[model samples]
Target chain A: MQWLHAVPWDLLLIQTINGIVTGMILALVASGLTLIFGIMDVVNFAHGEFLMLGAYIAVLTIVATHNFWLALIIASLGTGLIGALVYVTTLRPLLGRDPLTTILATFGVSLVLQNYALWQFGPVARKIPEPFSGSITLFHLDYSLYRLMIAGLSAAIIGGFWLFLKFGTWGIWIRATTQDRIMAQAMGIPVPWVLAGVFAIGSAMAGASGVLFGPLVGVDHAMGFDWILRAFIVVVVGGMGSLGGSVLAAIFISLLEAYSSLWVSPAQAGIISFVVLILTLLFRPTGLFVATPK
Target chain B: MTLKDLDKGQVTRRRVLAASGIGLGAAVLSPMPLRYALAQSKPYRIGSEQPLTGVAALGGKTALVGLQMAVDRINKAGGILGRAVELIVADDESKPDSGRRKVEKLVTEDNIDAHVGGYLSNICLACVPVFTENQVVNMISVCLDTTLTTSKCNKYTFRPYDFAPSQAKAFAPHLVNKMGKRWFIAYADYSWGQSTRDAYANEIKGNGGSVVGTLGIPLGTADMTPFLSKISGDFDGLFLIFFGPDSINFVNQGTDLGLRKKYKWAGDGAVAVASQLPALGDKIEGFVGVDRYVPVFDPPLDTPYLHAFYDEAVERLKKAGLENAAPDRYVQSNFEAMNALKLGIEKSKFQGRADSEKLIAALEGLEMKESADFPTGDKLLRKEDHQAFVRETIFEMREGKYHLLDTIPWQKSEVPPACTFA
Candidate 1:
């Protein structure tokens, strides 16, 4: 009771908002990565590069147009097109090869893309202006309205993607491919095209998250690096290829990290996520969010 | 027939001609400058390891430019000790392991006489041992971790620029008097940041101010807002210790969370490097910080040398695709560090790695004058700690330009040496 009384309630309230907002952004990024792995069985080491590409596209788009929405749309479309081209040119030929081949190929691709971004953009970080500049009082701090908008926008995007994966015809094809690629191909589902389309969608989602996140941090070549690691954690913890699980795990992990900051230092708090990852792997190999088999 | 062809003592005309031709070809093929090869044959091989394509690539690229500029200048002035200085560079890829490996190669394989580079502190710390083991002089360019000259100081390594404690000593009075009394410190949560934070905190306390709280955000933490959201309550100002993209990220996110409006913002000069200002836009307005060098042509720094250095740097940076970017501290410090090595070599008459002791002794109390080589200012590299205390300039950002506020002399900013060389 004494320890509870000493706890800063205001900090708790503030961290809740922080956790939720941060979780939504993480979920958006993880959704694309998990979606790709789920459908294609290709663990894209280049997923982060796609995210970086989206932010770079958004930077150019915003600079020319000064419209955040236009930038978001253009960046998503641009990254999606690039993703499709990547699939056809690189990933397609190595589809039936050993899993290690695809992994190495994507790793090679990541290096090329990262170096290319460094060469093209140089090392200086770029800026993307937020559309809204308003804030609301939240405890002792006045939080930026743009942060809340990012959370809301991410949710909306994820929600719309969920709907597409549920009822839409193309969504059925993707689900069918995820379940049985051979049967889907036999059923005249255009398996190769579906795979290409799924990659584009996954890449588009990554781009959207990148643009949304650009305003919070400098748009640099390595910006995607920091997020993609955590996204991998979220994917593994939520059950890889489980979009629903990834979303749930993202929020849970973020909240845990947020709450841990109260009792421990940030470096210690940061370690809790990795600890959780290790524990889950040891105890529940199927992932904490996945349904265990009887 | 074999014994006749092997003839060790035979001095036939054909054999002599063949031997002479082989010797001439070998001399011509040698990497040493042909003119210098005539007088003093061996070149002084200098190696630099930098994060050429990783997280710290921006500063690393700029640092390389400065080092090259110095080497070019040294060579143009008829080389050091009448021997041409050859520079060998290795890319560390911004990882400690890679940095150490590169340094090992630079030492054993390249057989470099000296080294002059480091951008990231951890990478620098990792490679310090390689330099020590090989008995090579290391002129650290831009790594500002306090322990480099303190607990972790080595005989082989020397930081020829300002570090955290001195910067803190120079700026804490201004921060306490002009800014607010109670402060919250946020830092990059790494080797450099943690050391810098402690230095500032101690200085602030010494100056009759209070450090209300401190937060250390892990390097490359995607969103600092979560960590920043924890920063609230009674704090008069927010002091930041970060560099590169981390600086831009923290400022952007912290401002987004209204921390900017709530508290007076001040930090390490790295937060507002000239290249990063365009990205920061108007957000950096009114932020006060301290640095040894800023790319402004003000009094004391308005010399013709600085102008020449600035013009060439600007043109080079433009060619490197950082168009219109002013040379940052990385560029300034690296240029000076290399030049300092040249001066040391010239004074010691150092030839190669065998003369490391002589070079170290000469550089111990070396005085650097304000020239193209040391365009920032005059300073002395302390014999005790191998750290130079340069004049610290406190400046404020106004319309994305650094406006000089005050300057603290090297004598005033110098802290007591705390290093014991092994």
Candidate 2:
């Protein structure tokens, strides 16, 4: 009873909000990575490098234009083009080959991209100035305005992506290609073009994630390494091909991380997330949302 | 003899004249003397391994710049023992295994005469055995774990940087006497952070202050809101035990949360280090912490020796287009370490392994006098631990620059007596 009385309700409320915001931001990045894996059957080991490149592009854009929205557009489109270039140059040849070859090739691409960034930008950390200042008060607790805006914008973008997939011509073509590539080709759909478009869209989302989180996270060459690990955990715990599943998993895991910090050390709290992942793998290999194969 | 006769038959009168001309050319250009040949041969290589790719890459690059400057200065003055010095650098990527491999390559493949490491205690700790096996002198800079100078202390390893316990002990007086008694600690959850937090905790307890709460943050953590939000107890100050970008993220978020406005802040002065402080600008004002060196000390109070070195360093930095290169602890430590190496080599008249042993003996307990090269007054190297004893400065951030508040004289007893080396 005394311990219950010692609880800081305001702090808990703030952390809960933080967890949700972090989850949404993470979902934006993970959704792209999962989408790429689902449609192409090719795991992009360089997905984290794309995020890093996006952050760097955002840094340049913000410094030059001083407009966050312009930075986002340029960063996303720039990174999207780079992603398509990577697929054409590296991934296309190995598409029908052994998956191991493609995986190693992507890993090599990751190293090249990381070292290239290191060479070009050096290792210093640069922060994107927050467009807005101060915090918004909700439930008598003040939350950072930039963080709240990121959450709101991330939710909107993710919602917009779902609607696009449901109605847009290119989005429908991408889905058809993903469901059955040979059949989609038989239906006179250009499978290769649709696949390329999906990859571009996925890469764009990852780029936008980087730009949105840049002000909060501090942009650096290796900033994407840790985020990519969390993104992987999110996709794994969610059904790999399921869009709704990844978002839900990200939120669930982030909430656990936030609430656990109140009781245990942050490192230990991180371990708890991995534990949940391992337990999910053991009990249901296909994840929470994926139906067990007969 | 038959073959020589056959070759002689092929040498005609024109060939003889041509051979004579070639001999003159060779004498004039190529084979001047054995001395010239030795001069153009291998230089005295000093190897350095640092995190050139990962999160701590900024610190690594800064330390390398300081080392390169020191080498250039030494080489300009006819080099060490009249032989030019060469620096062989390898990227460790902030990984201990990579550090070990790089050290092994430096000592074995490059055949480095001496080496230095910057940042990441785990990486430094990993390279310990590599140094021992190769019998190379490793001047460690910016890795603050006390065990390096205590239980893990070795003849091959010498630390020019201040350890965690010494810095904590030096700053304890101000934290307890001036600031309020209650404190909350937020620390990164690695070797350096854990050790630093422990050192501070002991100091606070010994000084009759109590801690209200403590939180551990993982490495590469971008968000600090979860930890900051939980600081609900009645604490007078917040002690941050983080380094590099992690430190930057914490301070930025802590300010946004208005925690800095509410509570007095104290931690490692490295939280506002050279490359990092400029980014934060005025936000770090009013914060105080302990530092190994602060280049902002002015004339009269600061030694003439220090001022002269500062002027030279600033000019060099400007010429290199590093206009923002301020003399933080990392740069100073590596610069000091390079000078100390030169001093040791000159004193002992280095020859080879036997002379390296003699150099180690000469360096142990060496009392360095204040000079243009060593501008930070007198420094002592304790024979038992090979830990450099330099005065610690407590600096407060004022007007976006560090102002030296007080200087703590070196106390031998401040560092715990060493245990036997493994």
Candidate 3:
């Protein structure tokens, strides 16, 4: 009882808020990665680089225009274009290859993108000016309004994406492509074009996530690397290609991170997630949301 | 008959004369400058390798800023040895092998007279052998792993910053006397962190402070809950020896767990970075740490030159909109190192590669009074270990700001005598 009360309620709440904000962003990035992996059977290791490119675009746009919304649009579109180009140039040629080849190729692409970014930006952390600056007091706790807004926006985007994936025409095509690419192609669906479109949309989502995260986390070349590990863990724990699982796992991991920091320490929080991952693999390799192998 | 015919090659003499005439004509009438002109126009090159795109990018960028600033200042002051310094910078990406390769490229291709900049201890350790092999002077700006100075110390490597043992020795007595006698240490499980923890533990015990517990977590850990929980029961002071983003995470979680209120927290220069203070907020209040520089130092004499440097740094940061940003120890250390290097160069009258060794030799006994730009006191760079015996400032965070509590002046301290070259 004493230990329970000893926990700093205010600090815990703040950290939880931070976690949720981070989790929402994670869900956005992971959703795109999971979608690419589901539809194309490609891990798309460069997905994080797409996010980084998005953030850099947003930073460049914001520096020029000083408008946040403009920056977001440009960042998303620019990332989508880059994603499509990546598919056409680097990925398209390697299609129908071994899974290991795809993974290794994507890893190489990621390295190329990282080095290109480093050469262009010269490794300085560029900050995107916050749109809604400062904080608001809620429940007698001061929280960054921008952070809360980001969380709300991320949730809305995720919900809209879920609805689209479930009911929309493109969503249906994506599912078909994921389930039976050969049959989908036999039915006269332009499979290659659909795959390219999916890559673009997925990479665009990652870009948008980067734009949203830029102001909160600051933009750096390595920001993509920082989140990629977590996104992989989130996707694994949520179940591969399971959008619902991704959402659930993201929240679970965030809450675990929040509560663990309250009870233990932040350094251990990462370990806890890995421990969960190991345990999940040991027991339910398909993750909490079990999915049939395609 | 065939050998004579070959030797008497009638067309060869005429062809050779014609080729020589064409070569002379091309050399005299070419659109581009001659080889001698190009050689005369080339600048003396200095090389630097840093983790420019990885986790240590910020530190690398800061070191670059210092290096460039020093180069600019030196150039403005009539240049080094009457020749302008040209810096050839490369990104090591925080990899040990990459760092060695980058140094090799710099030494072999760039023909750099001296090398500068190393943020990570691992990278520094890896590159030291390359520098030693090439007989190039390496002015290392950061990297606190004790092994860099002791076991790995080479004639070519000179560290401008105080090493781990000196930092530990500076803080331990203070922790025992001012804070408490029971100490708990939590550090990252890396060369830098391990060496720091070992040094601190030994010094704390030596200073009559008992180490109640010690915990080492892997690098890149985002959560420190279990480790913190295990040691939370009863320690008077907690010595945190983590760096970079890990330190930020630890302090935030430590605060959330109410660990700061229960025990006094002390950390190394990693925690002393002013940029990290805002992330810590009120949580870091009353937390004490050891650092090389603090903005709140009170000196008897106000040097205009120091004030100008401070004002310039503040202006540069403000223009970058990081004005309110906390001053990192690396940034301050780089500034001091630049100044120290200039002093060393001037004292030794360094003219070329041969003179760098003499400059390093002069650096061993050089001392400077802390002006506004640097802190007050004398720093003696030890000849044997190539480690600087510099003063460490003790500071406490107050209301999201750092306040200097005391200054530990440089004392001639012994290097870890047990360390030996294999």
Candidate 4:
């Protein structure tokens, strides 16, 4: 009771809200990663680079058209196209090879993308103009409206994805491929096309997340490095292949990070996620929402 | 037959005599003049090594710009020591080992008289040994780690900017008196961060303030919520010791969590970029940070040279389509350093690398005041430490921009007695 009273309630509430916003962004990134890994059994090390490309595309689109919504759409689609191209050109050759080989190939691709970005954009940070400006006041707390919008939009996108996966024809094929790739291929399903489609969809999701994140995080060549580790943690803790698990884990980790900083130091908050990750592996090795292998 | 033979022989003899006389005349005229001309026009080479493709590329690129600008200016003003100064540039890619190898190449292969541009402290540390071994003067523009001057100090390397310890000493008293007495320090867990924290803590404690807590975050930390929650309300101030993207994340997350509103925020290097304020918008307002450069200098002494530099930087940025990019003080510092190096070269009348060692000795003892560009005062290059004593400008971000709040001058008497050079 004393500890509860000792807590700064207003600050705690503000941090909690901030945590949820950060969690939503994390979930959006992890959802795509988990789906890709679950369906294709490929760890796209250049996933973050795809996000960077998306943000750059968004910036270019906005500059060319002056329509933010159009930029978001184009950026996501553009990243999807790039992802498809990567699947055909790089991932196709490495599909039946060692997992380490695939990992190394993706790492090489990541380096190439990062260097390309550096050469293209130079070293300066590019700011993404906020689509909506202003703050919403709630119980003496001033929260940015744009951040709240991001959280809401991320939630909606995740919800829509859930519905699509549960009901759509291609989504069924994706689920089948995740469950039994050989069986799905025997049943006249094009396995390669399914993998490529999953990769594209997953990459498009990442791209959308990037567009949404640009205003909050800003766009720089090194921006991908900042979020990729956290995304990995989220996917791992949420159970490697479970989208719902990722969302739950992201929120849980975000909340823990938020509350801990008030009692600890803000710098150590990132460690808490890893600690949770380790604890999850030790206790519930399958994660909070472990999917049964079909 | 006898008449014909006599005519042919006489003709051949006259031709040989004329040819011998002409050859002797040509030899007498060519040798001395060619020797004199060769001696008069030897090219002087200046080498630059920097991280052109990695994390420190922003600073390195700007420093390169300044180096190029200075070289162009010097050449346009009739070259150094009446010899054309040629620049040999190398990209170290932010690796210390790579930087060392590049410096070795610059010294052994390029045969440069002087070297400039070290954007990272680690790279600077790697480069100092090479410069010392080669006995070439190295003018470092961006490395701030104090150990670069202290334990690793050498005769050839000179730091224009104040080191971490000096920065901490200058900032601590002001923060303690003006902001609060209880402080929380947070930074990346690395040699650079550790040294900064140690120096800052000592200064803070010396100024009668207590360090409430300290946390060393790992590099590439994205989430700060957990760490923010741990800070006690008893703490009156937060000192962030981070740079680049980390600073931006910390400040934004700190604000979102209402930490900035709860306590006074202060730090070294984290909020030093002027462009960051506009990017941060309302988040960084009221946040006080210390830097070595401020756009505004005190009145009654504004020079056209300073204006010209600023105007040129703005124009170049605009031409590069960075019109909205914030003018960085670090870039200005690099520009100033390049100018100072040229000034040292002119003063020493250094002919080449042979004269560079003596020129470096002179540079270590040199002091400049009443320069057209530096109106506040000139930085004195202490021979003992090879460190420049320059003023630290303190600024606060207001309305998405930097406003000059104060200046801390670095005089000989102002330095602590414990500070010494071996």
TM-score for each predicted model, relative to the true structure? 0.95, 0.90, 0.72, 0.80
Best-to-worst order by lDDT is 1, 2, 4, 3
User: Model 3, chain A: how large is the TM-score?
Assistant: 0.93
Candidate 4 chain A least-lDDT 10 residues: A135-144
Residue-wise lDDT of candidate 4 within B69-119, one digit each (tens)?
A: 667767787776566778899999878899999989999998988887787
The per-residue C-alpha lDDT of model 2 at residue B260 equals 77
For model 3 chain B, where is the 10-residue window of minimal lDDT?
Answer: B412-421
lDDT by residue (A1-294, candidate 3, tens digit) is 888879877666666776787688788888888888878888889998999999999988987999999999999999999999999988888888888888998899998988788667654456565686555553333445776777788898789888887899877888888889999999877899989988998899899988987654446666687678888998888888888888788878877876776656566566788988898899888887656568
lDDT values of the candidates?
0.90, 0.80, 0.75, 0.76
Q: How many residue pairs clash in each candidate?
A: 0, 0, 14, 16
lDDT (tens digit, per residue) of candidate 4 on A76-111 = 899999988988899988887888888888888889
For model 2, how big is the CA root-mean-square deviation?
5.2
Q: Model 2: per-residue lDDT, tens digit, A1-294?
A: 898888867667777897999899988988898888888988888888888889899889888989988989999999999999888888988898999998999899999998888777766677777788887654433567888888899999899999898899878887888799899999999888877777788888988888888776567778788888888888889878778878988888999999898777656778877997899889876777677779
User: In candidate 4, how many Å is residue B193 off?
Assistant: 4.2
Per DockQ, the best of the predicted structures is 1
What's the TM-score, to 2 decimals, of chain B in model 1? 0.92
TM-score for chain B in model 4: 0.84
Q: After superposing candidate 3, which stretches have Cα over 4 Å from the reference?
A: A1-29, A50-164, A182-197, A200-220, A230-294, B1-44, B223-231, B276-283, B300-302, B315-327, B342-351, B354-360, B369-377, B412-422
Q: In order, what DockQ does each candidate have?
A: 0.79, 0.43, 0.14, 0.28
Predicted candidate 2 versus true structure: per-residue lDDT over B1-422, tens digit per residue = 24686667875678778878987777567753643455545577889998877878878877776777788889999888777888999999888888889889999999888887657988888998888898888888778877888878888888865787888888887898898798888887777888888889888888889888888887788767776676656789999888788888887777776777779998888788866775565667788988777777653337776777667766655554446667567777778888888888888866444457888987887777767666676687777888887778888888888788888877732676574655
What are the per-residue Cα lDDT tens digits for candidate 3 across B1-422?
24666678754777768878998887778764463343334555778787766777656765666566667766777665455778799889878888889889998888887777788888888888888877788878888888887877777777777887888888888899999999999997788998999899999999998998888877655434444445545669989987665676577556544576678888886864765554454556788888776566355214465456556666654443454653466666666676676677668866557677787787775666666435434676667677787777788888877777777767734344333433
